[model samples]
Target: MNVNIITIDGPSGSGKGTLAARLAAHYQYHLLDSGAIYRLLGLSLSEHGLLEQLNDDIAKCVAIAEQLPIVFKSTEQGVVVLLNGIDVSAKIRTEEVGEYASKVAAIPELREAVLQRQRDFAQAPGLIADGRDMATIVFPEAQVKIYLTASAESRAARRVKQLQGMGLDVRISDILANIQARDKRDMERTVAPLKPAEDAYFIDSSDIGIDEVFNLMTSHIDAKLANN
Candidate 1:
């Protein structure tokens, strides 16, 4: 049997993370959240007070990215991010860490350093990879490539709801602005800019529910698999 790999590439708040996990479970495949890997590196650098040294010392940044003590643990809730044996799932999801992750990821050498580590997750039964460049740059040969997207306003509203559920007070306006700013940075970044693969099936989930999106994706994947 051929190795089945599904790549979901999108910007933050595009629902790629949730979609990837669901697809992984539905197919019993391994999951890779490439952003989390960079987030772990960002968090580690922040803890070491080296985030500011990224552009200044590219060599140091590459060195740090080379030895990331990160692991992904699947659970009833979702995939949990572990750093050095400690659960840091919640810690890496903050806007601060996301910004850091984007900045650090822009360094070409740093991305190259962790490229193989990300590729290593593709194995056995299958793999569902999710991130900004999963389809275009990381898993170009994936059997199924999806580019999930949403309007900035819609994405910000979803993010606001998530933060409110955590009892955090956040303004929708602020969240929307942040989303737009992050979009600009991610798309303009020289290395691994956010974009859909030419062959990717694009889904704009601005007004759709997760289940509907999942159904659409599974339909696409099933058709692709049958043809393959």
Candidate 2:
């Protein structure tokens, strides 16, 4: 059997990450959380000494992405993201980093630099990749392609709950506005704009349980494999 390449693409707070992780665990496939890579890059350049001009900035961004030193430490608590020996899992979760990540993610040069690196994650065991562009751009030929989605309001509500669980004081309205803004920016970006691939299976998880999503995906995966 050929190694399975599973791509789960979705917007923020669409529960794609958790669903992808569970699928990876179920199949013992290597999981690639591609969004985290861009987040880490954004955090790395947060306090840069000087901003390069637009012409030269792309090269700089590409260089940084090409040499990004990221490590995923699986502790009992969960996955810990480390950059340059610093535990930045929490630091990279803030809104500031997220916005910056969106910016860097839209950079064509930066995307070109890390595109191959993301694809290299597919290997013997199998692979489940999660990101906005995983299905559309990174792994267009993925055997199993899923485009998960939720209402913007639902997504913001989920984010609010997530932040509150993290002991954060956040306003729902603010999150809603941010979500809309991000959606607009992401959909309008020139490079690798967010969209479902033609062959992707669309899923709405706003009212569905994670287990249900997983079961549905796994069954589809089995069918796809059998046909293959």
Candidate 3:
């Protein structure tokens, strides 16, 4: 099958997830929130008390990734994630889970285990992959590679608003610190570090709106598809 792919990569809170969803809907394509895969694994490890042993026992983490009991179902509302036959769409989005995911993602062996699962999402129509390494590692040959980013302060502000809307009490300072730490971990990782592919189109969304970002992406994608 010849499947065209668009990869949107960036640090957390860069609005890549939202933009990827919009692009998927617009093009009637499959959407892969790749980061969620790591987050789900992290949540599972936390539940099993193995998160702390990631560095000590790499084999176990790879085992879990190879046999993750997870499913992603698309609904009108959005993608609902199921872990072990139970929905964990909300559970995996917590800040704690995000931190756990960063730790596990840094392990090269575990990433290798999960890589194929992510590739399976590419199908006949197309795919919009969103995550830190989508462009840099996962989909280097993607036709449309986008690197969406924003200032640390802007990302933290957006995250604060999102948490508040969910009725969770969060302080901007704390969120900012977490974002900065995650950025460091993601970029400095030994394997598949978070960085834009050399040929990727970069967009700084610090002072822009979603609509504008979407337009920019679509325009580029449309041109690429036409040429392809």
Candidate 4:
């Protein structure tokens, strides 16, 4: 059976995750935060004391990806991720874990190992996948492809607000630098680099609000579903 899918791809802090989650609820579809998968893997590696050897021991990383003991539970608040039966929903969202995730994501072998696991999230109703390569790689055949982005400065400012809201002290300059660096790494990586799919609808949220972005995305999705 063919399942309808909507892919939202963009850089970190561009609000793709928030947008994807809202769309998933609106459509009552399964939500796949592909970045979270990598973060979980990164967290796992860190727990195993293998994070430092990512470059020296990629084989170990791939092996862990192939047998990731993770689970996603939906709650009114949001999805709760469990790693090895332990709740790590908050643990994997740290900036450090995000950096680790970015590094691991650049490894082609690790991405390949987790590819099928991501695809399995597609179910009968449909799915909304959020990630850097969702449109270009993971869900290339998705009915609606969206490349949502914002200026680096804008994204950094937003991230600062988020981190501050979480009671974490963060500097905008530091956050800006990290965002820029990650964008470079994600866009220049040789394998599955972050880029808009040829047929994707691009939306720059730099000057727009989340509600506006959501409306823009849903309009595209509605049109696509009507035609489908």
Candidate 5:
């Protein structure tokens, strides 16, 4: 069997990013982190001091996505996202950047610009893609599509802890509300709203360890290969 494409799609904080990187390492595959593209757009806008005018210059956002110089920097901890020659892994992690990413990602032109860039990462051995729309839009024909998700509360709690781990103090209640609001916005948006692809395999990681989630995903990958 030579199945070589794996897509992990989900909302933020569902452990999909960690699982996707693990799967890439396990299969020696190229990894495409699509969310980073949106983050890059947000960071690029911020760099120009034009973050406040993003809504007025939607075309500029698409242009940036159409030509993003974002790259993955391997660090001891995990992948650090770099934009336009600057290591902005920390700046992009803030709640403000996340919110801007959500809005920028909703633009139809921006999505189109980044679509092929995401697909071009797929290669011979395999490709593990992590993003909200990977299975649905970017790689609908992926051999194995995993929609990893968790309860809203669980996701928010994990995000809060993650922020605190980075030395940022935040309100758990605010994070929870933000998560719920994002869920609604992402699902109800006019463009490619976030939802599990029709043929995607769903997994809830509300109470599982990251390694355990990886095992479950790889077990399904093995089965998918057998089917292929």
Candidate 6:
């Protein structure tokens, strides 16, 4: 039988990751944190101090993306990103890495290099992918597509709380500004700009809880799977 796919596309802090994880667990499907893939690349580039060279040499970024020794392990808390056998889950969550990921994520060649890696995650049972362009670009043919979103301020507030829980002093205003900026970049980029697929189901998760979002998503997913 062919593996099925469900994509959840959203801006940062829109609960895409949480919803994707829940759906993955519920359906016994694989989870693909597509944003984390870019963030991991960002972390690698930052570590090697090659972020400055990204614009000058696109090939270098593509090279690093292809050679990344990354692994994703599901845990009681959530997914953990391991870089070359070293757990860098927290390392890649920094604001700086996120900004870098957004920048390099716009490079068409860089995205192409990692696109197949994202596709390969669709194994046996199924996959739940979460990212800005998951529905639009990476998994256009997915059986189910969801576009989740919230106001910039709301998302910023959520991000602030998450960072605070991680012991990071984050200001809501700063995060809001970053969200707005990233939204503009992701929407206006020349390659694979962030947008919902034509047939995607939309959910504004600003006021809803995680379980509410999961229920909404599963309703559509269940319908799709039943038909399949």
Candidate topping lDDT: 4
Expressed as tens digits, the lDDT of each residue in 73-118 for candidate 2 is 6655666889999999888878777887787787788888889989
Task: Report model 1's TM-score to 2 decimal places.
Answer: 0.97
In each prediction, how many residue pairs overlap at the backbone (N, C-alpha, C within less than 3 A)? 0, 0, 0, 0, 0, 0
Runs of candidate 2 exceeding 4 Å displacement: 49-56
Every candidate's lDDT: 0.91, 0.84, 0.92, 0.92, 0.83, 0.88
Pairwise TM-score winner, candidates 2 and 5: 2
State the lDDT of candidate 1 residue by residue for 40-64, as single tens digits.
9989888888898887877877887
- The estimated TM-scores of all candidates read 0.97, 0.93, 0.98, 0.97, 0.93, 0.96
Provide the global lDDT of candidate 1 against the true structure. Answer: 0.91
Off by over 4 Å in 5: 1-3, 49-55
Tens digits of per-residue lDDT for model 3, 1-228: 889999999999999888988899999999999989999999988887889998787788788889999888888888899999999998888899999999989988889999999989999799999999888778778999999999999999999999999999999999999999999999999999899999999999999999999999999999988999
Ranking by lDDT: 4, 3, 1, 6, 2, 5
Candidate 6 structure quality by residue, lDDT tens digits, 7-109? 9997887888877888888999999998999999888887888888887878787899999999999999988899999998887878888898998898888
Q: List the residue pairs that clash in candidate 4.
A: none
Q: Which ten residues in a row have the lowest lDDT in candidate 5?
A: 46-55
Candidate 3 runs further than 4 Å off = none
Which residues of candidate 1, in runs, are more than 4 Å off? Answer: none
Worst 10 residues of 6 by lDDT: 52-61
How many clashes in candidate 4? 0
Residue 109 error for model 3, in Å?
Answer: 0.8
Query: Compared with the true structure, what per-residue lDDT tens digits does model 4 show for residues 2-119?
Result: 7999999999999998899899999999999999999999999988898888878888878999999989888999889999999999888888999999988998899999999999
